[model samples]
Target: MTALTAEGLVLRGWEPGDAAALVEIYRDPAMLRWTRFPVTTAAEAEVWVANQQEGWAANTRHSFAVLDDERLVGCVALKRGIEVGYWTAAHARGRDVASRAVRALTAWAIGNGVTTLELRHQVDNEASCRVAEKSGFRLRETLPATPPWPLPGHLHLRTG
Candidate 1:
């Protein structure tokens, strides 16, 4: 997939130079709170980036580096059939970066034959819900106390 840009953010593939910024973004506490995943080490960050590269190589996933004015702010991806993993740097939140990124990805999904796009967020993440709505994904239902990964979250869908 080619790079896409919208709303002052560029979404493109990972690069070796993006490791440092990506590590910091993933280690940010807000991302941990929102996504319930922790990345505390540079090594873990490298592994994650490598896995992303592998996913791209294998065609199992499409990843992008969220860049704002030449700086890597975060990363987003469409993984495993319209499941989007979006995490922005703590500093990038509240500015609608994730919303813009998701919007571009959703348009691309529709172009690529995706019938439905799913967004799952922790029940407590109001900011995420707002993004989903702004990107045109309607809330479908609340999955009560699911398992392993935070329960009682919401499921939103965008169908065309």
Candidate 2:
């Protein structure tokens, strides 16, 4: 994987050493509250990152670590069918870190053969919606909770 630089943040492949810091980001209540998946332990985060690496190794998913200066701050990823997920440090939100990261990642994804990207946010998550809007995704529609995604959310799509 290649490291991406945009708007003062570094986006790169996951590193084993980034797990602890990733755990810290995931443990923040505000950050966790909106996430589709719940994460409660550092070890879990480590395992998650390890799994992310394995996915990267096999070319099934593309996960990138987001860094500010030298600190691991968050992540942005592309799953099957151009589905995307991203989270920024509680301290990093509202600073355009996500917008920049998304823009860079989207450019990379399209260049790599993804024709469209999809994202979702819970009904009440205006912050997340803002990120998607800022990143150029259009609101698709509200849908019933898909079998595995416990919560109901608004789906958005961006095609380029």
Candidate 3:
């Protein structure tokens, strides 16, 4: 994936060396709760990074590390040209990192011919709901809590 710069932040592909930084970010309970795949140990983090690389190669998923002045602050991803998700570390909360990263990714995806995008989060996660709205996605429906999603969720959509 191409590196993107926006609003004093950089969104770039995950690299092998990024595993260590990701380990630090995933230490937060919020990350563990929100993410499907949690990267707790160095080995898990490495495998996560490798999976991201493979996703990029397959053109099926695209993930970017959200950087602020070269420091890792968050992450964003576009999967299957439809679904989008993002997270901001505890240190970066309230700084609008998630919205900015998602917007940047959304713009790139649209430019590459993606007509619509989707964002979903547990209904209890008001913060993620806000991020989805701030990133220009509108709530489309309520999803029943499924096995992967522990709680009922909101589905947000953005169409180009």
Using TM-score as the measure, which candidate wins? 3
How much does candidate 2 score in TM-score? 0.90
Please list the residue runs of candidate 2 whose C-alpha ends up more than 4 Å from where it truly belongs after superposition: 147-151
TM-score of each: 0.92, 0.90, 0.97
Comparison by lDDT, 1 against 3, better one: 3
C-alpha lDDT of all candidate models, in order: 0.83, 0.83, 0.91
Model 2 lDDT tens row, 1-160? 7889978989999987887777678778987776666666777777888888988888888889998898877788888748888888887876888888888899888888888899887777787889899999999999777755566888989988
Per-residue lDDT of 140 in model 2: 92
Which sections of candidate 3 miss by over 4 Å? none
TM-score of 3: 0.97
Per-residue lDDT over 36-127 for candidate 3, one digit per residue giving the tens place of the 0 to 100 score: 88998999999999998999999989999889998999989998879997889899899999889999999999999999999988999999
TM-score of 1: 0.92
After TM-score superposition, the amount by which residue 12's alpha carbon in candidate 1 deviates from its true location, in angstroms, is: 0.4
